[model samples]
Target: MIRLRYATMPSNGGSRTSTGTIQTPPTPMADTSTEPEVQLRMFSQPRFLAAVRALVGTMAQRLGFTEMQCGQISLAVDEALCNVITHGYERRPDGQLWINFWALEGEPTGLKIVIEDLATQVDPDDIQPRDLDDIRPGGLGVHIIREVMDEVNWERRSPKGMRLTMIKRLQPGRNSELKNE
Candidate 1:
């Protein structure tokens, strides 16, 4: 089973809070029929983003994500990558963007994506939804990500960095064998 535990940090002047810890259970000794899952990580770059999009599409399709769902995830991911590249890395172009996608085993049909960057930290409490009435070109990425993903989580890593984790649940009745934790 996978568990998430929220934690508070006192190392950085008590100004930051972590979303949760991700814990995965050890593999079963009896059930050795299934293959191991894979994870992907990349740095901040145009080529990396393109590869991420393709990988998302392929995985979503294989997991039976609807066309709309795939598109929504793609857009949200793009926005997230852009934010990491621009705001997080301060447009350094040479910064790194780490991305990890994994199938949530023994769950109610779900997938999890984790994006981490060693850039300036963004306080989750500081992010506020923009007003719709006020026409503006900026400050819409966070809103869009929240709308598209089933669950969105943000946290600062110790000294310097931020990690964004997003989860999407697939349609019910497709994977009944797995149990939710």
Candidate 2:
């Protein structure tokens, strides 16, 4: 099971411009306590994918994840974002997507990433990867994310949104491949 403590969004709430850029970073988000969580709100535009991936990759690296594991985590995050943009938002550009990155603590140290989208709400049970036998040009994102992450959970957010939680734990026997300078 994956357990993580996340921070509450600022009381004032936050807003994003039409271009999907935040006018100001929210307060109470950079809690550097034990949990150390970061929340990012952006549009489902393809142009923001690189920045999001870089954020996830850097966080994974700092959390003592191996180089390959970091890549896997980043890939999983990318796929999740793409899935939200494509399937959830139906290729819409203005849809808002929020991602929360949590640094876990305890016996199995790891990272937890939550991708929440306020696009189209669907039953979590209905979301799954297509049959591999069909051999399609796409539709492997769910498969890849499930394979890479240690724990994955999906839920329909209250009102109108979907939440995807992914967690990856560092193996006890393996040491971190990257170190802080």
Candidate 3:
């Protein structure tokens, strides 16, 4: 996994403060190897959805899923993120969406994905897939997600927002190093 590093510097050409001393901020170091790799993005806009989809697709492929399966998984993830932007954040571009992807560390040997958003929380019980009998341009996200992933779970965050967890087991006969943690 790649590491993201950032360091803070004095804003005023190294000028001393009122106390006649300069202070340095601590550098930020992230332990990405053992932790679930995380990506923070702004998805409250319709335009950014494709990039999100591409990212998910790439990750899915990297996990040894076939191209076709990657597309399906990516589409499901796209729909879920769209719902987060439209419903959870109410289409407000300022809200942040956090997505994490990791290979499980135990028996299952599959991919694990978790999406989190600091937007309005929705009751998990209130979420349902639209009836297929009625066709429409919208409201099929929940259904698509359930259809593609082996496991789907939604939860309201403790203080605010919501989390969606989706998992897919390794394809039959395929071997992978990823396992449940």
Which parts of model 1 have CA positions greater than 4 angstroms off? 1-36, 174-181
The count of backbone overlaps in candidate 1 is: 2
TM-score of each: 0.71, 0.78, 0.75
lDDT of 3 by residue, 1-181 (tens): 1122122236866633132222221112122354454343454677877777787777677666778888998899889988998888888877767666776645656677777777898889989999999987899999999999999999877678888889987776665643233
Which candidate, 1 or 3, would have the higher lDDT against the true structure?
Answer: 3
- For every candidate structure, what is the RMSD over all alpha carbons to the true structure, in angstroms? 13.0, 8.1, 10.2
Backbone clash pairs in model 3 (N, Cα, C under 3 Å; residues 3+ apart or in different chains), count: 5
Scanning candidate 3 in windows of ten residues, the lowest lDDT window is: 22-31
Residue-level lDDT tens digits of model 2 in 1-181: 1122335555579632232333332232233353336667787788988887787888888878878988899999999999889988999888877777777777688888878777788887887888889896988998899999999988877667788888899899655443555
RMSD of 3: 10.2
What's the number of clashes in each of the models?
2, 0, 5
TM-score result, candidate 3: 0.75
Query: Which stretches of candidate 2 lie above 4 Å from their native place?
Result: 1-36, 175-179
lDDT of each residue in 1-181, candidate 1, tens digit only: 1122233348766644343344332222111343224344455666566667776776666676777888888878888988888888887866765566666656567677777677899788886667778897887888899998899988886667787888888877664232323
